[model samples]
Target chain A: MKDQKIVIIDYDAGNIQSVKYALERLGITPIVSKEEEVIRNADKVIFPGVGEAAWAMNSLRKNGLDLLIPQLTQPVLGICLGMQLMCESSEESNTKGLGIFPLEVKRFTNERKVPHMGWNQLEKLNGALFKGVVAMEFAYFVHSYYVPVSEDTLASCNYILDFSASLQKNNFYACQFHPEKSGAVGVQILKNFINL
Target chain B: MLSKRIIPCLDVKDGRTVKGVNFVDLRDAGDAVELAAYYAEQGADELVFLDITATHEKRKTLVELVQKVAKELNIPFTVGGGISTPEDVGVLLNAGADKVSINSSAVRNPNLISELASRFGSQCVVVAVDARFAAGKWEVYLNGGRLATGIDLFDWILEAERLGAGEILFTSMNHDGTKNGFANETLAKLSEMVNIPIIASGGAGNREHFADTFIEGKADAALAASVFHFKEIEIPSLKNYLKSKNIPVRI
Candidate 1:
C-alpha cells in the first residue's frame, strides 16, 4: 500500500510546524488542516498543540473539531495539549474534552514550576511509539498540565509527579512531549507512528 | 536513549558558509547543505545556522539556504540572526527550522519574545545572549557582539526566561574562538538561576572542556565552533569522554 496519509490537525495552538517538520523528516507528507475532509480521509491524524488548555480547547470547539477528532476511525496521534484534550476534562479551561481515554488533565501542583520544561526520561513504553526505543529514553517537554496515567497509559514521565507521556487506546495515540524536538529518538517514534 | 548531537554552526554571508576567528578574519566553509549532512552523519545531535549577513540584499538567499539544509538533514536544526519579527521566525521555521534563535532583536523589542512565545509557544523561541565582562560586570552585547546593551547578563537571562524563552544560548565573548574552555563559573551561575535549558558556547577547547561544562556549569548542552570545525574535538569522541566521566549523553 502507499504510505498512510498522515494529517496533522491545526487549530493554531502552536508546535504544528515542528510536528509537520518531524513527520516530513520521516518521509511522510503530513497535511496541516482544519478541513473536515482532509482529516476524515487521513489514515492517521496527529494533533499538535502548545498553549493554555482552555483556550486551545475553546479554539477546537469554535471550529467544531472537538467533535470531529474523537470520531476519527483511523489512528490519531495527539501531542502535548492535543493529548491533554483527549482526556475527560481539564483544569486549563474548565472545559470538557473528547473523553477518548479515561483520564483527567490537571495543573501541576504548585510545588514545582508551572511549565515543567526541558528533557525528561520516559518509561513503560507499552505501545507503538516505543516500538524499538530503549527504556528511559529522554524526550523534550514544555507544558503546565498533564494527563494522569490510566488503564490505556503507554508511556509516562516524572517531574513533580509521574504522568502519562504517551497514551494509546484502539485508534487513538497521543504524547505529552514534543517528539519533534527530542532528536533521533523522537524521529524514530514518528517513524513508528507512520509504520503503524 | 537519545543519540548524541554534533552540530555545525553555519555562519552565512552572501548565501555562503563563512568561518571567522574570534568573530573576525572571515573564511569560507563548505556548502551549507553538504556540510550539514556531513555533521549529521558524524553523529551531530542538531545543527545551528546563523545568518551573519542577514542584510537586505542577501535576505532571500538565507531562507533558500535553510530550505536546502532542511531537505538534506534528518536531525533537529535551529536558525538564528536578524530575526526581527514573528513573521521572520515563522518563515524560517516553515522553511524547515525546528527552532528560531533571536538575539539583538529581542533586546530591542522585548515584546517580540512574549508575542512569539504566545503564538508559537516558548519551546520554539531561543534567546541567544552574547555576554562580555565590562566595568566589573557581564553586559549583554548586540549586533553579533559589536554593541553593548548595558543589560546585566544574569538579569537578562532571568528576564528572558520569564518572558517565555524556551532556552538560553549563552556565548562568552571573552572565551569565543580562544580554544581554551567554557566559562564554567558564569555558566554555573546562570544554570543555577534559570529553569530553562542552557547551551554553553565559546571556549570549548578539548574533551575535558565538555565534561567541565556539564559537571561544573550544569549546562544541558555545550556548543563550540572552532573545536568542532578544525577537527580538534570530534563529536563522538567528546561524547565518549563525557560518558566516561559518568555524564549522561545520548550515544
Candidate 2:
C-alpha cells in the first residue's frame, strides 16, 4: 500500500491539507485533485471535508463529482462531512446525499450539546477498519449531526445516544470521526484503510 | 462518553515559545514545532499556541510554524493572538491550523465573529474571552487583562455565541498566575448557561486542580501554561490522576 496511488478529492469543504499531511506522515504522498479522471483511476480514494453540507454539495456538483463519487469501485474512505455526504440525506440543509448507504443523517436533539466535540471511545468494533484497533479506543470527533446504526455500521460511539461511528458497504467506508487527528490509533486506522 | 480534553498552551513570541520549558531533553525548547510535538506525545488531547508577534511581517512566521507543526503532530491545535480579519484567519487555516481563537479583535467588532463563522463554519471559530471579577460582576478585559471594559462577561459570551462562536475559551484573570485552582463556581455557571463546550483556562497548579475543574466546574477541557512548561504537572501523570478520579480522559 505504500506504493499505491492515493488521491484525495479536492472538494472545497475546508481543511483538506490535514488529510494530505496525515498521509504524508505515513510515507504516502496522495494527489489532491478535483479532476474526475484522476480520482477515478486512483488505487485508493480519500474523501475529506470540514464544513456545511449544502455549500459542499454545491462545490461537489460544480466539479461534476456528485455523479462520479458513488460509482467509485476502488476502496474509498469518507471522513467527517465526507462520511455524511455519502449517506441518503442530511438534516443540515435538507440536502439529498449520494445514497451509497441507506442511513439518514440527523441532528443531535440538544439533550446534551449541539456538536459532540471531543475524544470518544469506539465500541462494538467490526470489519477491516477496526483491524488492529481495540474496543473502547479513543478517537477525535467534532460533528453536529450523525447517522443511525444499521447493518453496515462497523463501529458505534455513544454521545447523547448510540450512533454509527463507522460504516461500510462493499468498497465504501465512512467514519464520523477525524482519524487524521486521532493520534496513534488514528494512524493505525489509516494504515488499515490503505492496506485494504 | 466524550473524554475531557487536557490542553497545554504555549506562549509564542515571533513564532518561538516565550515561556521557559523545563524539558532538559529538548534541544531547543523555544522551537514552537518541537514543543508542540512533545506535548502531543505526552498525551495532551490538544495544544493552543498564543502567538504574540507584534509586527505584520512576523505573523507570516506563525503560519510557517503552524505548517511545520501540523506536518509532524497528530493531535489538534489552535492558534491565536492578534488575529483581526478573515484574511488573517484564512492564511492560518490554510497553513493547517484546526481552529483560530479571537479575543480583542472579536470584542472590538462583533460582526467579525459572524463573518468568520459564515466563511469557515462555526467549528473553526473560537471566541477567547479574558475577564476578572469587578464591581459585583465579571468584567471583560482587553490587552491581556491590562485594560478594563464596561462589558459584563456573561452578556458578551452569550452575544458572541449568538453571533456564531463554536467554543468559548474563558480565562479568569484573577486566578491565572495564582496557582491555586480554577474558578469552578463561575465555570459551572458558564456550562449551565451555554449549550456549547466551555474551555477553562488559568489557575492550574496541580493534577487535582484539573480534576476539580472538570468535576465541580463541569468544563469540557482545562488549559494551563506555566504548570506544564515548568514540569510542575506532567500531562501523563495528570491524566492518570484524572482517570483515578473517574474523569474520562484519552490516555
Candidate 3:
C-alpha cells in the first residue's frame, strides 16, 4: 500500500507544496505532475487548487489537464478551488468549471464576509471520504465562492447559508476546504481518502 | 460561523524564540520549533513566526526552522520579517509556511503587496503594520518600530486592501507589552475601515484582554507574545475564558 502510486495534479494552482508535505507526513510519497499519462495511471489522484478561477482554468486548459481530469477512473480528491473547479461553473469572473459534479458555484452574497475564512463544522457526513469521521467535526476553510447544497453533496456547512462542504459522485470526491491545513480531523479525512 | 482566533506570536532571533517590549531588549524564550509544537497541542488557533533579525544567513535558518515546525505541527502557521520580493515569499511558502506577512517591504513599495497577491493568492499574503500614536495621530512605523513613515494608519490599510492584502496585522506600538489591554479604540475603527480580517497584536495581558479585543476591538483575531511566552496566560485557560464569555473559540 505504501508503494502505491499517488499523483497530485499540478496545473500551477497554489497550495501544492502543502499537499505534498501532508502526504509525506502520512508516509506516502505523492508524485506532483502535469503529465496526463502519470495522472491517469496513478492509484489515486489529488486535484488541489488555490487561486483565481479564470487563471486556474486557463492553466488547466493550457496544460490540457482540463480534459484529462474527468477521464481518470481512480479516486480523485479536489480541495478548495479544486472543488469549485469540479462544478459546472462559478460566479467568480463568470468562469466555467470542469462540470464533473453538475453543480453551479456561487459567491456568498450575504453581509457576513467575503472570504469566509476559518474553521467551520462539517455536518451530515455521508461518504467514504468521511469514514470514521464524526458529525459536526470542524475543518479549516478559506474561500469566497461555494457550491450550493445539492443531492451530490456529501457534507454541508453553514456560513451565510448552507453550502456543500464536500461532494461525492461515482469515483470523484472533492472538499471545499484545505485538509492539509486543517489539523487532526483533516488528517483523518486524508487517511480515509488514501484508503479509498 | 467562524470562531474568533487566538494566535501566539513567536519572535525568532538566530533560530531561537525571543520576547521583547516595544520591539527592543530581546530576551531568549526557548527553541522556536518546541514552542510551536507546544502551542499546537494547547489548541492555539494559529502560530506566527517572525524572524526579528532576518539577516542574509538568518533567513536560511528561518526556512529550515519553518520546515521543522511545519512537519511537526498540524495547525496553520504564518512567517514574516524581511520578506521583500516574490521569490522570498516563494521560498518561505515552499518551506511550508501557510501564510507570509510583509511589513517594511510593503510599506516601502506598495506594489509589492499586489505582486505577492498576484503570484500567490491574496489569502497567502498578510500585510503587517506597526503603528504608533504620535503627534495626536496614529502613524505607521517601519524597521521594527524604529522609524516613522508619516503615513496615516487608516489610509495605508485601506490602500493595502485595495492592493490585495488578504488580512491586516495591526500592532500598536504604544500598547505593546503593556499588559493593560489592546488598542480597542483604534482597532475597532480599523476593523470598520476594511472588510478584510484584522489581527490585533500587542498589549494582551489577561484573559479579559482577549475578550475585549474580540468584543470591543472587533478584531477577527488577537495576537500576543510576552503574555504567552512568560506563561502569564495559558492557551487552554485563555480559550476556555473566551468561550465562557460567549466568544467562539476552537477549543
What is the i-RMS of every prediction? 4.6, 0.7, 1.5
User: How is the predicted docking of candidate 2 categorized under the CAPRI scheme?
Assistant: high
lDDT against true structure, model 3:
0.89
Model 3 compared with the native: what TM-score?
A: 0.95
Task: Compose the digit string of candidate 2's lDDT tens values, residues A2-84.
Answer: 89999999977888888899999999989999999999999999999998998899999999999999999999999999999
TM-score of each: 0.88, 0.99, 0.95
| lDDT agreement with native, every candidate | 0.80, 0.93, 0.89
Candidate 2, pairs of clashing residues: none
Order of quality (TM-score): 2, 3, 1
Fnat scores for every prediction: 0.11, 0.80, 0.46
Candidates, ranked, lDDT: 2, 3, 1
Flag clash pairs in model 3: none
Model 1: lDDT of residue B182: 87
* Candidate 3, B1-251: lDDT as tens digits: 67888898988887777764232222323678777877788888889998987568768888888888887777888999989999999888888888999999999999999998888888888999999997799999999999999999999999999999989999999999798999999999998888888999989989999999999999999999878777788999998998899998876
Native contact fraction (fnat) of model 3: 0.46
Candidate 1: deviation at residue B61, Å? 2.2
Write model 1 residue lDDT over B1-251, tens digit each, in one string.
Answer: 32223355767776677774232222324567776776676767677888888467777898888777776666668899889998898788777776899999999998899998877777778899999986789999998889988899998999999899988999999998787888899998998887777888988888998888888887777777777667777787877887789886756
Residue A150 alpha-carbon offset, candidate 1, angstroms: 2.8
- Model 1 lDDT per residue over A1-196, tens place: 2377888898877757667766776767777899999999998889888766777888998889989999989988888888988999988768788888877798888664446755678888887678888888777777878888778889888878888899999989998987777767787888888778
